[model samples]
Target: MTRKSTGIPGLDSMLQNGFAFPSAILVAGEPGTGKTTLAVQSLFHGAREGEKGLYITAISEPQWLVQKFLSSFSFYDQQLVEKGMVNFIDLGPSIAKNPSDMLEIIKKKIEQYQPERIAIDPITPMTDLLQWRGETREFMHELFAFLKAFNSLVIITAEMSYDDIAHSQESYMVDGVIVLSYPEEEKVRRKFLEVLKMRGTKHTTGRQLIDITDEGLAVQAGLR
Candidate 1:
């Protein structure tokens, strides 16, 4: 199977070179755990490598505002964005008005952008809306199945904790699950990335140390 580079310094090592192309990867983590940063960084990496990237936002933040905040990170490239290599679009309005149409809308966007690497930052809101409407299972089933229809890589970010992952519908729907956590160690909270589940990849077994630097997520080490 062809592997798609994750773009993180040591993450590819964890996934035995990279993620499987055409796979849906769930990046679950708590607030402020650098989920957006990691996703954006990977998109930028792909952009640099001649692969178009699409960033779908669920919170409906303005594109300029998103770029402004991301500008602080060294990995963020305004040039790539300007060159049309990376595109950022929002699905908040669609989810708010017609939650049921989200999957269709996303499919349309994917067809429009034709991006090789895609990121759905924080899919929690959409799932919450679906679960509230009692359509989560159907949506999840369709979403996961549709992900494999493309040759591109899909990275879906979610707001979840380590415990939530075990029972979450999103976790079970994807091809891979990478949990990011901030655990208290030695009287301080440290960031960690663990590949809890990866199909067809001999991924690293335990939590890997990571740092959220100006350049973006950097894997610091393997299992303790």
Candidate 2:
């Protein structure tokens, strides 16, 4: 099987040269846990390698606002976007009445761009929108199947509260699950990364400290 490195330094080593290509990974984390940064960085890393990358966002945040937030990171590459190597699609304002519309839109984008790597930043909104509607499971199944068929290394981010990580179904369905968390220890907030489950691969089993600076997220070597 072909493998695509996450390009997140220590993280790839943990996954034994990074996630398997054409697989779906779920990045679950609480607010301010650097989920967006990790996802965007992966996209940019692939883009720099001359691979087509796509970022699909469901949050209502404007394109400029999203760009502004990512601009703070040194890994944020503007040239890729300008050159059409990297693309962003916003699904926020369009489908307020139906969440299933998100599936169709995403499918269209994948078909059009055929990106080698894709990131769906914070899929929390879509999950919330599907709650009680009995469509989330179907949506996930279809989406995952579609991405696998599209042959893209896909990352889906989910906003999780302290307890949501244990209760969410998204974590169970993905090929791999990466959890970012900030636990209060000794009166200090410590950020860590846990590779919960990765199919067909031997990965780091324990939680490791993660640092998110201007260069983006990197797992502490000492923790390995």
Off by over 4 Å in 1: 221-224
Q: For candidate 2, what is the lDDT?
A: 0.87
**Model 1: per-residue Cα lDDT over 1-224, one tens digit each:** 98878999889988889989878899999989989998999999999999999999888877678888898999888899989899999998777989999999998999999999999998988888888789989988887787788879899999998989999988888889998999898899999898999999998888888998887898996444
Tens digit per residue, CA lDDT, model 2, 1-224: 78988979799999989989889999988889989999999999999888899999888888999899898898888888999888998988875677878889889988998899999988889877887798888988888778777888989999886477666778777899899999899999989999989999999898899998889999988667
Alpha carbon lDDT at 81, candidate 1: 92
Q: Give each model's whole-structure lDDT.
A: 0.90, 0.87
- Model 1 clash number: 0
Check candidate 2 and list the clashing pairs: none
